[model samples]
Target: MAISEKELLEAGFSNRDVDTLLERLSATGGTMQGFIAALSRRFR
Candidate 1:
């Protein structure tokens, strides 16, 4: 399932957070897995 802004927001993330994620994804070759890994490191 593709993660949507609305879905992330519903999951308690703010728009700025979502935007930062997208920016990071783009920086890291736009890979979802990379974004996920980055997030994992963040909440750890």
Candidate 2:
């Protein structure tokens, strides 16, 4: 994904949370859709 820290902040995640999300992205094979799906798993 081509996301920046600025974009992540603008999306409402804190700096610390952005790192966590980035790590999650890596764990899920680094696709934005994979990231969203991982997040969905958390809320479900």
Candidate 3:
């Protein structure tokens, strides 16, 4: 399954952040967990 632009927007992400995330996902073959983990680390 793929993430959609609507989902990102609904999740409260700004358009720029959404675009960056989408690019990262494409570069990593849709691996979202790592991105989430990285975000967690940043906030922790």
Q: For each candidate in turn, give its C-alpha RMSD to the true structure in angstroms.
A: 2.7, 3.6, 3.3
Candidate models: Cα lDDT each: 0.78, 0.77, 0.78
TM-score of predicted model 3? 0.53
lDDT for 20 (candidate 2): 86
- Which residue pairs clash in candidate 2? none
Model 1 scores what on Cα lDDT? 0.78
Q: Candidate 2 lDDT, tens digit per residue, 1-44?
A: 55577887998989899888778778867876666667779999
Specify the highest-TM-score model's number. Answer: 1
RMSD of 1: 2.7
Candidate 1 lDDT score at position 11: 93
Model 3 lDDT tens row, 1-44: 45567876898999998889878889878666667667779999
Any residue pairs clashing in model 3, and if so which?
A: none
Tens digits of per-residue lDDT for model 1 on 1-44? Answer: 36677888999999899899889778867876656676689999
TM-score of candidate 1 relative to the true fold: 0.62
Q: Which ten residues in a row have the lowest lDDT in candidate 2?
A: 31-40
